[model samples]
Target chain A: MMKYYFSTEKMSVGYHGQPLIENIEIALDKGEILTLVGPNGAGKSTVLKSIARQLSLIGGTVCLDGKDVEKMSGTQLSQNMAVVLTEKLRTELMTCEDVAASGRYPYTGRFGILSDADRLAVREVMELVRVTDLKDQDFTRISDGQRQRVMLARALCQAPQILILDEPTSYLDVRYKLEFLSLLQELCRKKGLTVIMSLHELEFAARISDKILCLNGKYMERFGSPEEIFTPGYLSHLFSIETGSYDEENGTMELEPAGGEPKVFVIAGGGTGRNVYRRLQRQGIPFVTGILFSNDLDYPVARALAAEVIEAEAFEPITQTCLERAKKRLVECERVICCKDSFGTFDRANEELLAYAKHIKPQLIVQTNFEVIELDQKEQNKSQEQKDHDKFNSVTQKSKVENQNQTHNVRKEGIAPINQKR
Target chain B: MQHRRKMRYTAAFLLLGIGVLAAVALNVCIGTVEIPLADILSSLRGQTIQNERILWDIRLPRTLAALILGGALALAGYLLQTFFHNPIAGPFVLGISSGAKMAVALVMVFLMGRAVRVSSTAMIAAAFLGAMLSMGFVLVMSRKVEQMSMLIVSGVMIGYICSAITELVVTFASDAQIVNLHNWSRGSFSGMTWEQVQVMAGVVAVTSAVVFLLSKPLGAYQLGEAYARNMGVNIRLLRALLVVLSSFLSACIVAFAGPVSFVGIAVPHLVKSLLGTAKPILMIPACFLGGSVFCLFCDLLSRILFAPTELSISTVTAIFGAPVVLWVMIRRRQERTA
Candidate 1:
């Protein structure tokens, strides 16, 4: 058997003696990353807390380096494992250096004074997390992103073989999220630190985790490699997501499409209809898109946002059957939108279809941009009303902008508002 | 930058030391019986003079008691604040002093009823039991209510209850016993003998030294209990040590001087603000000094403010210390909003 560095067997975790998730078994090698991912309140944090020993396990045994974790003393366990919890640190009058140096608690002298070697370790970890410049700044005064980095540095300074974090990237923006996860990857690679953390962002978890555990509040839904866990139709079912769709392969998400019969037909191909499909979706206008190859860059977005997508096989020429289907959708739609600027030999059928649309409908609006075109005079009146509404919105938006400017100027000059001044 | 911080710490310590020396000197020199500096000097040099009885017996013991017991109170306050992670937490605010007062009063009343004399150790033991009882109640309340404000409120309620009980016991005592208990109950450092000073100094010194040794874990504890546990500090043991040490300090103060108000709370906050950091390693000794300085000043004011009539030490401490507590609250509110 391959040697496992950390493992939990038949572990049950909960609060106040009531088990929320039971029989969770996880095994990992020395340098692997295990991520727990689920919806909110799905016991991801509960399991992570139990593994970190922040909470008492309801049942079962957690083993580290072939030793039972419960059997080890707190100091020994702390030397082996370090954790960054979700609870906000309410530290007062502490510098970032002080916060990070606290990780040396187990190694310090009787007075908890940091040694030169301990200081070097703190410096090294702070540098690793790019928080060396913030060493003297108050921990509470830093931005959330910087604070998370400092917390990671604190955990790193523990010099542990295992690291556990609960939603470490929850407060971080996109760039910091990427940086934080990448730093974890580096730690795993360079220091051989085995990381077990719960993550809210499934995309980051998929990209960064070596092993993934799916939780659903009642049980460990699945535990395997990221490739095994992130599959088609699995995440949607796990999260019970009904309002949108998640793309496991590309790690993208799309809002729910407008649900109605196709009122707008988009003749698009070669990644041209991506923006048009999203715009129509945003406007709640049901649309149908066609003549897209299965491997087209815009195919996933169209499939996600369009009421219907007519597609061909990758690298296959447009066929007669696809043209017939497109014609039927075009007839059903009151307007046809051509997103392509030019056509190739493979799109000869789409060209023929466009010609058919122009011949059949005399008032065909051939627009380069994907602006909505009304079919009848009555629809044109509706567009006129929409234009008036847009004009009104613009006036209000301008006034809001001017109000913001006035407030900014007043604040800069340290003056009260006009009404408040009276 | 570290060198600059170290220099600042050194300067602060020097300033506090000087302030303590000045306060002690003023406390000893300025009294109702205005002994000349030359006479005081001779008395110090073992020349038994006209003012010798006043200096050695009255001024010296009272001033020493003020210093030792005041430092003990502040150290106890620091430990309680750290334990609760509440800036306003202190021996008096947390009802610990009142609890000690109640126990000591009960013991005094019971022993005096039987015409029995209580030893200094017996009084300390009684006061310690009372402090532990109140601390236990507060700890249980803290677990039930996660809000620090609620914990403080509950602690104040406990203080009121303990004080009421102590008053009831004092109410039924005979006039002769009440004469001595009355002054001590309202909090005064008067009538402290040299023997009592030695006992209190020994207790306070040993306790403060243990607190200093615990600076490492106490520093970790400032991050909160969960983080302290993760940092390998035994949460249970540290908490237990905090309760015992704080109780011992406050019990000693209550047994000697009787529930002196606000010094326990105010001194630590002032010391922390002056030092510009909350590192327990620095704060433990600084707070002790700050407490000594604060009490010495208050005691001096109490002695000379009304000339012939003396004011209670609690009255002076509340006049000075309550405002600091209010300032702490206001600053904390602003910090939250900011």
Candidate 2:
């Protein structure tokens, strides 16, 4: 049996003696990352707060380095663990450096004055977080991303063995979110720091966390390595997703599939039909897509957005039955959209399917690829003429508001907004 | 940048020190009986001067009480501000001083009715009880109301109620008792005996020293309660200590000089602004010195401004301090809107 570096055995956490989540058994090694992922109001924060000793655990014991957390003095706990919480720090005219320097509280002597070593540790952590330039900036005045970084630096300045963060990435924008997680991963690796944090972003949790803990209504739904926890259909089951589908492998959620009977047939393969699938999904027009091999790049996307996906086995010949099924589905649709242009070895099935559709109903083909250049040129010429007319002080024929209303109507009608005029 | 911050702190302290020295000198010399500066110096050198009676007996004890009580009031205000995380929180504004005043008034009336002499200790003890009662009410209200303005409005309401009760107690007193009660209720630094000064000195000295020792946890607590607890600071204990210390300081002020208006809120705020930081180690001392300077000058103006007919110290302090409070509120509103 592996001896855990830190673990919670049958832990229960809640507010005011009412347990929201119970029997949370978590085990972690020295330098691993554990992330709690759940829907809103899933008590992710309550668990983190409990582990940080901000909230009393309702049941069970949290052992850190073989010592029970409740038995450790506050100073001992603080010296070993530090927390970054979602609650905004209410500061008064404190510089970023001053805020970060406050992490020395456990180490500082009387009056909480920073010694030379304490100052050095603060500086090192600030530098590690790339916030040395922001040392003199007011903590309140900084951007949210920088503020989170400064808070992380403050926590790191504690030189803690275990770091607990409560939804630390909630305030960051996309770029900062990636950067923050990457920095956290780096810290865990380099410092052997055990980390536990709650994150709403499942993609980051899946990618960054060594172990993933899933939480829902009143229990720990599952806890395991990310590989075990992020299995297919688990998230949708855990979150009770009704509309949109989530691909556990991709760690991404897709728009709900267009409902009702199929109207459009998308001849999709080799990543070509990805855009049209999403466009059709957004248009809420039920679509039937494929004749894609199971291993095809667009297979999963087609399965997500289409009402029915006609299929083929991976690395196998295009069967006569598969092409016949595609032909039947193709003819039943009002229009056929083939996204691929040139045919190749694997493109034989799509080419055959397109040919069969053309023979049965030529008007349904709606070929857009070849004429796109001419359409773009025509639109640009029209715009040039308008500009020249304006230069000559000529008034437009239509009111601007009427034109704007028409554009909005086109958007509402779900016409493709970009590069699809043909 | 660090060097400049240190220099700014040094300069701010120097300015406060010089202002205190100047205010004390002016208060000592420029009284109704103008003994020249040299005569005052010689009097300090043990030679009796032309107005030794006015300087030593009248002005000296009163000035000392003002200095000590003023410092205590501002320190009390700083602690309350830190507790609430609102710069406007103070003893006078939060009705803490009024509560102390009410209790002191009731005790004085009952004692004087029996022809019993009220010692400074008894007055301070009574004031502490009253201050803690008001503080407890404010603490309860603070939990219910999230808005800072609502807290202040409720505190103002509490102050009015306490002030009314104090006045009612004074009204029931006899005419001879009424004179002393009136001056005390009006809030002044008058009629100070050396014995009373010694008592206040002892209480304020020990309390301020305890407060200074708590500057470490107080620093962490300023960031808010959760972070303070995470920092190994016992948040509940620190909060309790803050309430007790600040109430004791304000109770001492109320016991000796009654409720001097606005110094509790205004002085700490001005000092924090002047120093360009809110580090508790720096703010605690600076607020004390700032309050001393502010009260000394305000006390001096109260005496020499009206001369024979003395303006109460609260009136003088209000004239100066109320605008600072207004300025703070306006700035807060601007920041919110911006």
Candidate 3:
């Protein structure tokens, strides 16, 4: 039988003897990254703690290299596995080098003094994590990102075959998060290290992980390759994300579209409508976009945010029926926005529709830049003159009062103000 | 950078060693009846001089007691601080010395009442038991309260309780024994005989060696328990060893010289700052030397500042040590906000 590098069989874990997640099964090969993605309080840390032997297992066994971990001595287990926990390391007068050198504990002799070889190992690992410059700085005095790198260096100094991390990127900024994970990927490749960690960033998890485990506090919801687990509807359902849509193919997310009848019609194609669609969505204006090919670059976003979309098959000319539908949508819209700078032969129908829109709503034809024509000459003159400052202040004050009263009315109706404001 | 650090460590150790020798000499030479340096030197050469009895019987034992017990107290504080991961944790602050005091007092009073002499070994054993008891309470309280200040507050409360019980026992002692018990309980290194000095040296030497050997786990432990465990330290074993070793060291001090205040808490902090590093290998030996120097200085002050009518050792220690504790608290607060 082929041997798996690490596996858990019927493992159950929790605090104080009550199992919160049970019957967990995992298998991994060398040089693989396994990420646990789940809602908060979903037992990700508990599972990690059990495997690290920081917490007692409620049931079953975790095997490393076909040997049950429960049977190994602490020193043996430590020599094979290292962990970077979420707990803050608060030390007194400890240089970063001292902190990293402590990872040589299992290899040192009786007094725990480091030999020349051990010192070399510490130096190499610090270099690996790019923390050599911070060697003499106090561990407690460094930034969180620098401290995380030092901690990872400390873990690497253990020279373990398997590394476990608990939310290693929780406190890091965007740059450090990407750097830290990329470093992990490099270690996994160069050293054939098996990595198991829990990540809150679903996109990073999907991109970097060989396998993903979904946990829901009581049980394992799913476990498989990211491709199998990150299906379109699955991630949103798993996270109970009711207010946003998650795109599985690209691993991108979008907020829920504005709810109401289409107030604006966007005549866009070839990715030109994406920004306008998002801008209108941010402004809480429902919009209809039409005459977009099925394979248009902006199709996914338009599908996610637009209230109505008129789409034709990929590489096909705009159908007469689809053009009629777009013309009908254009009539219902108070304004038509044309995002196309130019049209090809296949989009002749879109050009015709644009002309129809100009004929029907002559003043409403705005280009993709979204600059509207000034229809009222007197209103435009009053806004353009600097002498209208007092008039602007009075109007702003009236609107502020009206908004306060509206919020008060909503509160009185017992609906939460957060939802109303959004 | 490495060479500079090595030089710093070497300089610190040399300075501390010189300081300890100076303090020892000053302690042995200056007293109510000061001896000349020449006479002191001759007496050390085994000559029978006019000040031989005074030097051999009183000054020598008391000086050695201060040095040995002082080192024990500081090492105990270092171990406790590492175990708790709190800078202010020590024998006195954690009530361990008071616990040992209570236990030794009970044994002394009980043995005296029964017309039996208590051996030094029995006294140390009883004191060790008491120290462990107080340590147990502190551990439980630490588990319940994560705040370092709260743990210290609870330890202070435990100290008060143990002191009150000891006071009640002392109040009922016979008149003949009251003076000795009172002087000991007030915390003094006076009346230390050569035999008692020998016993204390042996205890301190063995215990300090064990602490030195434990530098590895102690260093690992300084990062906090989770990382220490990841580094292959057996948490349970290390924790139990810490409790027992710290208790033993503090118990030896209480058994020999009573419950001296602040030496356990202040000397380690002073030593760590002086060295500018908390690496346990250097810190363990440095704290021992620092503690000896500190106690010798305080004991000398107690003996000569109010000559012939000596102050209790605790009074001298509190005068010099309490301010360090306050400074540590202020620095900790600043560190938190920063």
Local accuracy of candidate 2 as per-residue lDDT tens digits, B1-338: 87899899999999998988887788877778876889888988999778778888888898888888889889999999998988799999999999999999999999999999999999999999999999999999999999988998899899999999988988888999999999988889989999999999999999999999999998888887778888888888888889999999999999999889999999998998999999989999899989999999999899888788889999999999999999998987886675
Where does the lowest 10-residue lDDT sum fall in candidate 1 chain A? Answer: A410-419
**Candidate 1 structure quality by residue, lDDT tens digits, B1-338:** 78988998999999999999988888888988887777777878888778778888999899999999989989999999988889999999999999999999999999998999888999999999999999999999999999999999999999999999999999999998899889989999999999999999999999999999999888888887777778877888988999999999999999999989999899999999898899999999999999999999999999999977889999999999999999999999998887
Query: What is candidate 2's DockQ?
Result: 0.71
Give, for candidate 2 chain A, the lowest lDDT window spanning 10 residues: A371-380
- Error in Å for residue A85 of model 1: 1.6
- Against the reference, the lDDT scores of all candidates come to 0.87, 0.86, 0.86
Using DockQ as the yardstick, the better of models 2 and 3 is 2
Docking quality (DockQ) of candidate 1: 0.64
Model 3 chain B lDDT-worst window of ten: B224-233
lDDT of 1 at B304: 99
* Predicted complex 1: CAPRI docking category: medium
